[model samples]
Structures are given as structure tokens and as C-alpha cells.
Target: MMEADILIENCSEIHTLKGPDRPRRGDEMQDTSKIKNGALAVKGESILAVGSDKEIKRDVEAEKIIDASGKTVIPGFVDPHTHLIYSGSREDELAMKIQGKTYMEILEEGGGILRTVRATRKASKQRLLEESKARMDRMLAHGTTTAEAKSGYGLDKKNEIKCLEVIDELDKSHDLDLIPTYLGAHSLPPEFERSEDYIDYCIEDVLPEIADKDLAEYCDVFCEKGVFDVEESRRLLKKAKQFGLKARVHADEIENIGCSKMAAELDAISAEHLVKTDEEDIIMMAESGTIGILLPGTPFMLMEEKYAPARQMIENGMAIALATDLNPNCWTESMQMVITLACLQMKMTPSEALTAATFNSARALDRPDIGSLEKGKKADFLVLDIPNIDHLPYRFGVNLVEKVYKRGEKV
Candidate 1:
């Protein structure tokens, strides 16, 4: 009964992925099925209908039609964890790491995240916004419709809010939906001599002001060995929840600090970077419905030995997601590059990698409204230049995205 504003016709294959259980049975958790010779009709900002070409054509009249004769149609990739607002690149640190300086050693020498924090604090908000906008343009070109950008590079409250405000302004101006997360608990600023005092200030001072202004939807903390411990992260996230923010944690990236278990117990939306997370934490996360977010690019870039237990998580029936971890520290804003790294290094199938990047990643953000192409869902999808979907990961290290559309309009 709904008339369509646009229709994409004669797609080589349309990947609807319109189901609750993903990693579709019998394929590796990364493989997805397709509907051959498909068509999708959209009205306003939602999918009006989808089916074989004949069926969709019969149901609605389209005001605009796009002939995607040789392309593959897929739901737009959703990236939920990223630190896109920073001042400069870490190429010098990358060079040092390649020269055999360890990540922790670099951090100790004040050359890692702290270095970026200093640079970001000095940069103007307009400059940060300019750099972040460029990165987001690249992400959109690579077929990402929705993404979460964190503000961890700004360790202090003023710079942190400035970074979040950049994200807020981007959402109003850009086509992509940018979700902002406040991460004052990311690290101890130079002014704070004691880590405990830093945690207290983040929880008591900054978080309340952020919540009052409705600046962020989520509050995150780094619950690693040198960062806020599991106990500190717990108290901080617990207090943030009282102020109406959902919880997220940077857990076990460098060591087993019990972040995954705490996130599971608290029913946090997700726990990211579980390279060193224990088997007990794995079981707990699976049982509690907390999504496990993996950052393959971080391990690949850092050449770390510990990889998130992807196969183990899939086998245990835990929902798993993949992210670029797009920060100044490790990863870049290339989601396709992350897909290739996830498939090759983490031993995930191409299909499973796609699912992890799309549907499951949306779940990690505690969102069900986006990520999949179903009737009545948001009309966000990518039209790939490739004919086959399997080529996404198989033919890696190349850009195959031909066109991207969101909200029933070509962006």
C-alpha cells in the first residue's frame, strides 16, 4: 500500500540478512546467503518492499529507479567503535614500533596515546572537526552508513567535550549517523598524579556534565593493566549508568584485567579488544548476551600474538562483531581493510566477517533499527561494483564500492 520513492532493480544478488540469528547456518560465521535477481523498493527513509524483481515490481510504483544490473546489494556496514577525532598521525611511533620498540615501552616513553592527547589538546576544535570530517568522508566512500566515534585522544575534560561536539556537528552536516561516546576514563591525564584521583574526577565531575548536556549515549573506560583497573572501570560505568548512559569497556587489550566478566555482569552493550580475555570471561559474555567486539587491525598493525578468540566465540553461540578500532593508536578508518585483516589474520570466513561488520556490530551498539535489510527497516545499503559478494574479502586490499545510499536517497 506504501508507494516507493526509489527502486533498485535487477540486482545480481540482494543480501537481505533479515533474521534474528546471524552467521547463517552451515556457513562460517562470516558467510551470508543471497537472493538472486532481486529488487528493493524504498519509501522516504524506510524499505517499503523487497523480493524477486517480478514481485517487487508488482507491489509498488517508484518515482526514481536505479538499474543495478551487475552489482551486489548489501546492507551498509556499521562501525560502532572508533576514535576519529584526533590532531595528527602516529607515523613516528609506527616507525619506532617497526624499529623494535614495544607498544608498552612506547607508552612508557610518552610516545603513544599520550602523545596524541597532547597534540589534540593543543589543536583548535575547528581543526579537529576538519580532520575528523575528512576521515568520515573516506569511511562513507567505503560503504559505512553508521559509525560511532569516540573521544579518547582528549584525556582532559575540555578537549574531550570538544571532540564530542565535533562528532555532534558532523551528524547534523554529514550523511552518516555518527554516534558519540565520552571516554574521559580512557587514561590518566598529566595533571592527575594518581590514577585513582583521575577515575574519581571522570566519574564525579566530567560524566555528570556530559549527561546533563546529553553529549553522549555511551560512557567507556579502558580497563587494562596500566589504565583503569576492572574495579575502577566498574565504579565509573556503574555511576554513568545512573546518569542514563549505557556502558562499554576497553577490556583485555594488553592483559587480563577482568573487564569482559565485569561487562557481562553489568550487562554492558559490548566489551571490545579481548585479545587477553580469559576463557571464563568468554563463557560469561556468551551467557549474558554481551557482544564481543574484535579489532583485527590493531593486532595486525601492532603484530601482537594474542587475537580475539573468534572461532571459540562463534562456537559457543556468542554474538561476535568486528571493528576497525580507528584510533590514532593502532587502526585506520578503512572498514574494508579491517574486513580483509579479519578474514586473513583472525581466520574468519569472508561471509562471517561481513556479518560481524554489519548486523552484529549494530547489536554491539544496542541498536536493532539499522544493519539489516528487512521490510520496514531503514533504507541503508551499499551497491558494490563487484558481481559476487564473496569477492569482498577474497579480493582484498582494493576498493570495490561503486555507490552508497542511505535513507532512500543516494548519498
Candidate 2:
């Protein structure tokens, strides 16, 4: 018999999400690879075995045993996109959005990303660490064991490095595993006259420093009309590529503007906020293997009626992923709520949303170890209060995560 460090038995269901090594596309997203009346054993920091409850109990002995008799078990969520290091809140902007101000309108009025940038820049490093650690605690409690955090609120070299440093500290000190991305081209800072000039600054100055420090693994750009346009986004991302950083794009949230197409051309790993993505961009991304990371929270918070054409993307054979887009504008820690929004607003099925939140989101961040429950994978998973998979999205508004485990240890 195999000795186990921990054994969880008699779970009503376990969504292993074991399938293709790559991101799920088309009909592939629907299959969650569920095991009914399931059990799993954890040995150190990896999954030892997963099978039917009786089979696992008969084969393995453990120091600690948990009987999750009526609960669902699933992989801990992997949020591929989040601005988790910012120092301030934007509650006042909620009223502005309600009073009929567009996101760009609020930004042009000096009250969006720039507002948060000012607050973040003014905050001491310790203060920023304190604030960000609190958010990480919230995210962990909400069942996100791993996430991709972006440094966009800090646009300049000094502040950008500070933000990445905070992320590094958080990763070391907090249980939520963070993959940092340098997003200095999120918007045109007030100090720069043109978006092109800001891109130049980020390319010539910030990119090299960040790469040398090994602070961020990915480089992201906001490809929007009133923000950095496609060409500017292209230059920054390409330069980031030259500096050994993988690329991600904030594409077509408010408008198409050829950003998704440009992302396909650049072979960005993922394109986020594809609210306005058309069929051509979808097909191009499918061919280029660039997954569309749909952020339902962003559109829901923006109070916009149009969401990403998820059903169309799925039908057209494009792989899809989901994220919180957890910035000042969206402000959500719950992947559960994001799943609800994906199902109700974007028309993604519950399983598709779950797959997107876990498996595909891992692919978005280029991490393969944390999003599935399988032998040799990292033992990161959630024990939900719910009895079945559908209850994940069905039991909306409240947290269903009864317990969260990271690397074989409960957290």
C-alpha cells in the first residue's frame, strides 16, 4: 500500500480537468473530466492518485484523512489576469459609471487608471505590500491558489519596479502563487505627451531593467483606442519579446481597432477583454493558438450590454479562457462570480466557465502544473460546500469554497 501525507475520500465529485495538454478548444471545453464518488491522495506537494473513493481508500493510507462525503472537489482557480498590486480603491467611479460616463470618458477626465496610478505612486512600498497582501488573502479564501498579477498602475520605471517587487514579496510571503507581468504600457501616463513616447520610454528604459532584474515573466499592453493603440502596443510587446518576456494583450474591451488581429500576428499567448472581438479575429487567434481570455467582470462592471462573443468563439474552434480582470475598475476576487457572469452574460456553460477559470487560465499564464488534479501535478484544489459541479455557478453570489489547499497543505 502507498503511504500518503493526506487523503480526501468520498467526495461526491472531483473535477480533475485532465485532458489535452494544451488549452481546450471548441467542444473540448465542455468536458471537465469529473470523477463521481471520488477520492484523492496527496503525497508531499503533488497529487499521488485520483480515483473512485473505494479504490483510493483500498490502495492508500494517510496520516490525515478528510471525508468530504457530500461536497465537490475541483482544481484551485488560476486567474490569468489581475492588477492585484494597486494601493487604492475606486468606489467613487461606480457613481460616475452609473451616471453615464464611459470608461474612456472617466479616464480622459483623470479619474480611471490614472487616478489609481497617482494613489499607488504616492503609497510607500510597505503600504503597498500591506494592501496587496490583504487582497491576496481575500483571493486565497475565495479559492484562487494561483494568479497572474500585472504591474500597470505603476507606469514609470521606478514605480513599475516597485510594483513588481511588491508582487515578488507577496509571492514569497503569501500562499497565493503569483506570476508577475510588466504592464508599463497599460495607458499613456500624464508625464508623456504621446502614447508613442510612453511606449518608447517603456521599451528603451523600463523593459531592459525589468528583464535584467527577472521581475516579470510576461509583458502586457492595453490595446484600446483612447489608451495605447495597436501599433504602440505592438512595439512595446515586440520589444518585451526581445527582452525574453512572453506577451499578453488587453485587446478590444471597448472597441476592436484591429488589436486582436495584431495579437494574432504577434502570437501573443492570450488576448484579454475581447468584448468587441469579431469572427475574423477569433479565427485568426484560433489559428495562431492565442487564446481569448474573456473578462465578463469588466463588461459587467462597465455596465455595458455587449460581452465577448464566447459562444461564437467556441463554435468557431477558438480556445477560450476566463479571468476577473481584477483591477480598480472591476474589483472582484471571486472566480465564482466570474463563472456566474460567464454563464449568464457570455452564454458559456458552467463546465466551460470552470475549465476556463482553471485549465485554460493556467495556459494563459503559461503554467501547466496548478490547474488540474492529476498524478504528479501540484496538489492545489478546492473542496466546495456544494454537492455537484453545476452548483458552483448555480449557488451564485456567495463563496462555495469550503476549504482551499495549496501544494498538499490546507490554507
Give per-residue CA lDDT, model 1, range 1-411, as digits (tens).
Answer: 558899999999888777755323224354455688999999889988888988888887888999999899999999988988899888888889889998778888878878889999999988988998898998899989999889888877888888888889999999988988988888888899888899888887788889988999999999988778888899999999999999999998888868899999999989998988777888898888888889988888887776888877777777788888998766577778888887777888777888888888887886687888888889999999878777888877778888888887888
> lDDT by residue for model 2 over 345-367, one digit each (tens)?
98899999999999999998888
Best by TM-score: 2
Candidate 2: list runs displaced more than 4 Å.
101-109
- What's the true lDDT of residue 393 in model 2? 75
Best by lDDT: 2
What is the lDDT, from 0 to 100, of the residue 247 in candidate 1? 93
The CA lDDT of each predicted structure is 0.85, 0.93
Candidate 1 lDDT (Cα, 0 to 1): 0.85
